[model samples]
Target: MITARREAWTGRVLLVLLMAITILPFLSLFVTALHPSGTYPPGLSWPGEPQWGNFLKAFQAARMGELLKSSTLIVLGVVPIALVIATMAGFAIGHLRTAGRNVVFIAFVLGLTLPFEGIITPLYYQVRDMGLLNTRWAIILPLIGLFMPFSVFWMRAHFVNMPAELSESARIDGANTWQLFWRVHVPLAMPAISSLAILLFLWTWNQFLLAIVLVDDPLKRTMSGALGAFQGQWGTDIPLLCAGSLLILAPTLVIFVIFQRRFVTALLQGSLKG
Candidate 1:
């Protein structure tokens, strides 16, 4: 009992430490943002008078409204389509065991190793040739494809772990492939699907590199993409820049907070399924 209590206390301490590590930087950013735009307040020092309006100034200066719309559109464009493709691909590779499924799965596994940066040059030329270089489609199309390796891997993990008996029973009931996938397996896969949705939402939202590189118009780029240009313009203005950064991050933080439970559940579910 004493040893168990000691271990529990140690675990609590570790968790607390990790939470602090995760939270402190954001807290620091929040504090820094409240300072006057041009000033560099000392380490963790509170400003004499907080510049609360800096957020508004940052918002307008960064064209956040437009960025938000672009981000929303891009996210909406990417997430659903990616989820469907990933889910179907995962179901095939992990559960259905269709002909050439192993080969396809192997290709996806190989995609996991292909970093975006490495292929950005080729991708840029390809997008240019297609006349998509300066457009949101450049970012959206690539992300859906780029995200597939991991997304499919995650969904496949969930589906493969589903009991074989369930599929067998559904098949015995004369369910077609579509009905089997839609009715029996999909409901069971909700936790994993919801989790993947949350993940794809986050990734697509904060997709900075591709957005910045592909879309020349900052307003048409994602919030994070705009941040790069925002930084370039106001790099010298520490507080204003921090304020813009925080504003850009607000949606992501809100989404995570709301869906945190689902995300954690999916992670735990995946681990147990494995």
Candidate 2:
């Protein structure tokens, strides 16, 4: 009993330490953000007066409204289409025993090995050739393609691990392939799909490289993408810059907080299946 109590106390202490370590930086950012603009306070130092209006100032100066709209459009354009394609491809690969399915799966696995840096230059030229440069499609199309490897892999893992009895029972009931997929599999896969949607939302929102590189207009780029240009313009204004950074981070933070339970459940399920 003594040993168990001691171990429990140690674990609690460790958890508290970990929480502090994780939270301190964000606390510092919030504190720094509230410092009056043009007054650079030292680390963790509180300003004489906190300027909560700095967020409004940053929002106006950065044209964050337009940036947010662009990000929403890109994310909406990417996530649903990518989810549908990845789910269908995963189902085909995982459930169907068609010839050449292994070859196709291997192709996608190879796609996972190809990094953004390796393809960015060629992608730029291709987009330019297609007259998509400086357009939202420039970012949207590539993001969908780039996201495929991981998304398909994730969905495929879920489908592959699902009990074969489920599929066998559906088949016995005279369900066609379409019915098997839409009626039987999709409903059961909701948790995994929801988890993937949250991940895709995060990735799409936080996407920086493609947004910055593909689109020339900061207003047309994602919030993070525009941050690069915003930084260049306002790097010296520490408080306002921090304020702007927090603004960009807020949506993703809200999303994670809301769906955190689903995310955790999916992760635990994936681990157990693996």
Candidate 3:
């Protein structure tokens, strides 16, 4: 009992330290953002008097309004359809005994190993050739495909563990495949679906590399992608830049805080089911 207690205490201390490490940069950024515009603080230090205007200045200068709209539109275009495709695919592979299931699952598993950076050159050329360059579709279309591997895997982990008896009973009621999926399985999959939605929203909203490489117009890019240009323009204005970054990070922080439980639940479910 004493040894176990010591181990538990050690784990608790490690967790606390890890949490602090994670939070430190954001704390530094928040503190730095409070400094006057154009001034760089030597380290993490609070200003004598806060320069609250820096946030407003950063917001307007960064064109956050436009970036926010573009990010929202891209996320909308990506998440729902991706979810639909991923969920259907997951259901087919996990619950249903479809032909070539192992081969298809292996294909998706291999897709997990593909690096996003490796495809950028070819992806850009393909997008340009297709006349999608500088458009949101350039980002949106590719992200849906890119996200599928992990998305389908996560959903499959859930559906695979569902009792086959559920499908058997549903079929006895004269339910077809479509009805079994739509009426029975989908409602029960809401926890997994909701958590996946939260994750995809965060990913699609914050996607920077694809957004930057594919789209040129800063206004059309994701808020994070636009930050590259914003930083280039305002790099000297450290406080303003930090403030703008914090602003860009706020929505995601709010979302994660709100849905953190669901996210944690998803992790737990995956572990238990797997």
Question: Candidate 3, clashing residue pairs?
Answer: none
TM-score of 1: 0.96
Point out the worst 10-residue segment of candidate 2 by lDDT. 93-102
Candidate 1 residue runs with Cα over 4 Å from true position: none
TM-score of 2: 0.95
lDDT of each: 0.91, 0.92, 0.94
lDDT of 3 by residue, 113-194 (tens): 9999999999999999999999999999999999999999988988999999999999999999999999999999988999
**Model 2 agreement with the true structure over 79-155: per-residue lDDT tens digits:** 99999999999999988777898898999999999999899999999999999999999999999999999999999
Q: Give every collision pair in model 2.
A: none
Candidate 2: list runs displaced more than 4 Å. Answer: 1-7
Alpha-carbon shift of residue 49 in model 1 (angstroms): 1.1
Better candidate number, 1 or 2, judged by lDDT: 2
Query: What value does the lDDT take at residue 201 in candidate 3?
Result: 96
Query: What lDDT score is found at residue 23 in candidate 3?
Result: 99
Considering every candidate listed, which one attains the maximal TM-score? 3
